[model samples]
Target chain A: MTNLTAQTRHHLVTARVENKAGVLLRVAGLFSRRGYNIISLAVAPTDDPAFSRISIVVDVESNLLQQVIDQLDKLINVVAITELDPEEATQAELLLATLARSVEHDADLGVLIQSAGASIVEMTDQATTIQLVAEPTVLDDFEEKLRSYGISELQRTGAVALPRLVQL
Target chain B: MKLTGAQALIKSLEREGVEVLFGLPGGAILPVYDPIIDSSIRHILVRHEQGAGHAAEGYAQVTGRPGVAMVTSGPGATNIVTALADAYMDSVPIVVITGQVATTSIGTDAFQEVDTTGITASVTKHNWLITDANDISRIVAEAFHVATTGRPGPVLIDFPKDVANATIDYEEPGELELPGYRVASAPDERSVAAAVELIAAAERPVLYVGGGVIKADAAKELAHFVGLTGIPVTTTLMARGAYPDAEALHLGMPGMHGAFAAVTAIQRCDLLISFGARFDDRVTGRVEDFAKGAKVIHVDIDRAEIGKVRRPEVGIVADCRLAISALNEQIAKNSAAQSRDRIATWVERCLDWKQRFPFTYEGAGTAAPGDIGRIKPQFVVEELRRLTPPETILVAGVGQHQMWAAQHWGFVDPRSWVNSGGLGTMGFAVPAAIGAKVGCPSKMVWAVDGDGCFQMTAQELVTASSERIPVKIAILNNAYLGMVRQWQHMFYEQRYSEVYLSPDLPDYVKWAEAMGCVGLRVTDPKDVAAAIEQANAVNDRPVVVDFRTDSMEHVFPMVPAGASNDEILVHPSQADQPR
Candidate 1:
């Protein structure tokens, strides 16, 4: 009714392409060439695959966003394409780990982080590592709460999502 | 097949295409020097170890290759840490090789021995202490790979003396095995769509571009995005020349000491799209209030930068070039366009702000009756800009002169404008100029310095003259560290610290003359041009022009420390009477 396109919470796009040289160049080239920013991407080979499957998470309008899928399909090695919605399909998770400097020295801080769904992964004299997997906002809140405990270093892997149902 | 660790190091360097090294010779690193005699690698012996580090920075900046510098352990390595830090902060790719005391001497508090690895850990991207001869080739190869890859930065390899002398079968350099690190090239599409939506909806938008664009070579894509969106763009100090100043939408630098128009536009924007920029303190003054009215969208290659400061309304952790292109596609498909009148209104407001607070200097109103005929710093910058060709690389000593150069000079190429932007190190320009001249021998390199900064490492003039590097130095001799004194005068109630060096000036000029270089002193404003001309004429040897500038003149458009970007002390004009 507003005439403006309604924004979706998230989008999932799967691209199957050759795992050859500059395949990255072509894929990245397509996105950057179009001025698109991918939020989360999981790239790996499928079970029957001579080709690689690239799962891309992007927020875009339905019509123009379909063009990206078509473009990915046009790549010489690209075999197929599928766009998934988090609300309808299964969800994937992204893992983030941050090394905390003190644990026993800051007991309440450690308990507070665990409350945010982060588990103590590793502990050493210099630092303790806390691992978390959740929505981006939860990760943000977890990192923010742990800051008072002093974070020495941090690392996060690309988001990996799967369909909630096993059916293809 | 057996060779000394030092020999393997040299061989690995040769394979890496290293042609020159800048460093000082010391006891621990003598073995490396021995191999240098036979190798094709040329070593430029600097007067000081620190000069060697900055020289490497200069070489790295110009060549886009990893600059190599060699130094001995202990004081030698410590001396070069400031330069290493400068390279680190600026993201200059440099490979620093230092010699440690022999293996047996470890933890003995041996003479001339210090923990070079520990000393440089924070300053280097990656570093290793090679205790075994067998690990030499692998470590050297990995150092080069690490230094030149991803976001290029300085890497160090601390070679123990005994390890350098020890012999083993040398293996050829192999593929680098860095499993944890991979430079992100593709953008996440969801983030791109969100950014496009924000861009399409916003009435007043500003594109804040930073050095990451130049580093990733995404200038063309960035320009195209700006063109399509018709959004005004502002760069951080490091991102100068990414978008040409002559471009219609380019608003120059923003934040503390930035253009008044840029700061005002950023403050008034409805949305701020940050591309490849780390929101540094200097750029984002008091982060909480910065762009308070806008919905911030930050796009960078590094995920660590997303929520570091001033939480973004939409944070896209992807390469700017890729992200912008994706967003452009979405916008094109949707055909979502904002009203042209809104853009026009913002542009008119920006123009009005520029007119109100123009950056200018008016010669102290014909000079006071008893004025000592001091040269104005602005005149020095203007004269240098006039005399030099557009391609001339201007390197500056950190302080008032550096900021003045940044504000005044309109750089036309990426990497053409180089400075220790965040580090703000004094005594940087001379050696850096030499390195720049060495890297691009055909181009004219000018080392702009202040009297205070020039004296810090002015001894390198001897090295410059001896090497016949032909770096023309224009020293803005205000006889005081102008920036510090300005802060003291404005904020500290004029209680000047040890900033003056008047009576000691004669000794420095005499030293320059003694070092086989021509030294000219300019007191009157008219003599400034003639002195610069004379320095240009002496191309065979390095020339130093000492322009005695006014001690009281201050750099305007200053956002004092802890102040918001919107608040700036604009230069006093004719109507506004000076206190």
Candidate 2:
């Protein structure tokens, strides 16, 4: 059985695919059927309207990375695939958290949020919604700190990545 | 021209030169069926959707064209799933068109509605759920293109009821817009040169061929290469007829249930030249230990399959025909005299093994010690082969009977043998035989099936009878799930499980007669040839012959599952004999 935890090695695969119905399903279906764990996934239209780029963080054994790439490459809708190495790629994630608001929670949380590069997006009588745009690891840390303030709801937009600009 | 999506679908099929299609009608697919009636293509109305799918596979295998199957939504779509998976596993080209609920009601739990595209996505090479009638022709063209190209497999198009009913200006699809889909073209010159070097250097080499050779229509090229090099060739189950069985350099088959010489030669060979054959677990036995000493030259059209199993020393991603032609060219240029001279002793040794450890059964003409009123399946298969025309197409169901038929029947022509090799789907023979017979009406087709397999989809014989297809069927009725029973007998200390299905129950002859077939039952080994001759004589309709074979007879030269090929078990009688 494959280890599905986050601690296992994660391969960030970015696939440019035709922007068509059921293409995402086909891509996701391949992963599920093959029993490969998806740590995270993000999809959006690329610069070209005809194609969409899907960023997938797959938790797989080291030896199976080639298989993951090969299998993904077989999908008819997938135009191209590139494994974005962490050192050579830039990744970003967005995290939103709705936390309970009170005098007791407000003081220390403000300092923590500032240090973590998070901002208060919305404020209400009983709750405060915070937004964080950072690397996945920083987002994870920011989300963890918000947990102590009695979180009501939270969501993370999975990481999206691109190759870093090469120095000429 | 203005046309409904249904009309466009039929026109597209006509443009694709589809002569016949297997299908069943249902509410959601009624619109498409309406157009099929007026189309030039002959539509075979199969009794069940599964039969339709398998029949399409049969047609594709024999004709080298993508088999077409159509079925309705929901239950009908689900029924064909097994056949689709079977085609996917075997890389048989087929296009399955399934009806879906109207686009408006697709997710509203409409009547006879299911996610046909989603259900089949994994099993198919590619699939589409049509939303526009305008795109019907293009999708159909693309579907055929995908199904028949690069490691050909099944493709599907889920046609919704509204889309079928909608009108549009029908136009031929432009050049296929599939940028991502590309087949392996000519191999790298470096890889080809490297492979040729390996071929010229290795003293002992075995040419491992698979079904891809048949798919690529490369048997002639493969034969020419083998002839030039004098390399021993072993055809896998899917490749039984790819290489002529009577060739001097032919090793029968490799892997589990393969000929001893074939399996042992692969184990002992120094060079394993895999031509279009995936290193399937069934062929490799145990991956780590299979051909441990051999350097591999793997050539296949599917890039994913090349290094997916065994890492080859020289991997060439090219069509088998092209790859073989390239190798032959290089070999000619290199003049492999030293290689041929060095491998002479090795070739002689392999041929000796082939002559000595030939497939044999104990008491072939008589029953085993305590089992009276029974015939050995091998004898029945051998007699069937002898009685039938050499060019006859033999379709086999999965089990001991299938192995028996494969071992006993000598196939010389390509596409003469069709069996579910990769998936090992039982109940495949009956419908597939029907399809093969329909595709090649001039040829004699026979479905050599097991009783267990016969029970699964035997109703398709009724379609055969009603359509006046004269495909013969030989049911090796051993009154048990023969293959599973053999496993229980060998590894499970003879603790028989629920493998027994009484031979008398349902009375196969009566069942055949009920289905409008001329039924014959053979209890004596002497009567086997007579029964087959009688079946062959009846050319008006299908015939079913039930040969009451011994349940105890197991397929020999068995490489125990997951065991090393070096430890292959030969026949009990041949066990412990001097090498």
The best candidate in terms of TM-score: 2
Report the alpha-carbon TM-score of model 2 versus the true structure: 0.95
Provide fnat values for all models in the order shown: 0.00, 0.63
List the lowest-lDDT window of 10 residues for candidate 1 chain A: A1-10
lDDT of each residue in B456-533, candidate 1, tens digit only:
787777888888888888888777878999999989999999888782455556767997788777778877777777
How high is the TM-score of chain A in model 1? Answer: 0.75
> What does candidate 2's lDDT look like per residue over B1-579, in tens digits?
999988999999999999998999999999999988788899888999999999999999999998999999999999999999999999999999999999999899999998888899999999999998988988999999999988899999999999999999999998887988877878788999999999988999999999888888999999889878999999999999999988999989887999999999999999999988999999899999999999999999988887888889999999988988898888878877235787999999999999888898887534432144568888887787778889999999998988988888988899989899989999999999999998889999998999999999999999999989889999999999999999999999999999999988979999999999999999887788889899999999999998888878899989999999988999988887655
Docking class of 1: incorrect
> Please, what is the TM-score per model?
0.75, 0.95
- Candidate 1: segments with Cα more than 4 A from true spot: A1-168, B320-341, B363-373, B503-508, B574-579
Give the range where candidate 2 chain B is weakest over 10 consecutive residues by summed lDDT.
B364-373
**What is the lDDT for B233 in model 2?**
95
Candidate 1 backbone clash number: 23
